[model samples]
Target: MVAEKDANAAKEILQQFEAARTQVGELVTAAEKNNQHFDQLIAADNAAGHAIINQAIMALVAQTGSIERAAGIIGIDNLNPDTADHEF
Candidate 1:
């Protein structure tokens, strides 16, 4: 009868809605995992870059006197010894 058909249609609509919701949840989970993986990759790369930067900083500190002279040679005002007495 019409009542039974209406109930069946309602059930089908409900099932479809649930399927859509589940698919959305799955997609969101996958995206979140991908984002986490990407973040980890970026962090590792940054860590590597950090090591290089640290080594460069140490080398610059080691050659502090030459840095001031090199700065003058390169026309970079920031590297002048008279401007900043600090190693950085």
Candidate 2:
């Protein structure tokens, strides 16, 4: 009876993990889509949009006290000096 209970518990845990994994996968897809849209918006030749985005990034950097940390929080990568010259 104890062995059966253990096996049942393991199966329940596995089912919950699978459900969580599916939910995470859906969230990742949504985030990716949103990121793509943001990239497109930033790529456009809109000075106001650029300024707003830069301001938001600067605010995050100021609040976090590190540009890298701000970028990480916003799911951005490769925020090096060369690429971020215009951003600051």
Off by over 4 Å in 1: 1-5, 34-88
Per-residue lDDT of candidate 2, residues 2-87 (tens digit): 22445554454455445555544443453475453445546678564465455555544443334344345456777654434454
Model 1 agreement with the true structure over 5-88: per-residue lDDT tens digits: 455544544554455555444434534754433244336556643443455444445355444444444456764355355545
lDDT of each: 0.47, 0.49
Candidate achieving the largest lDDT: 2
| TM-score for predicted model 1 compared with the true structure | 0.32
- List the candidate 2 regions with Cα displacement exceeding 4 Å: 1-5, 33-88
RMSD of each: 27.6, 14.6
Worst 10 residues of 2 by lDDT: 61-70
Candidate 1: residue pairs that collide: none
65, model 2: CA deviation in Å?
35
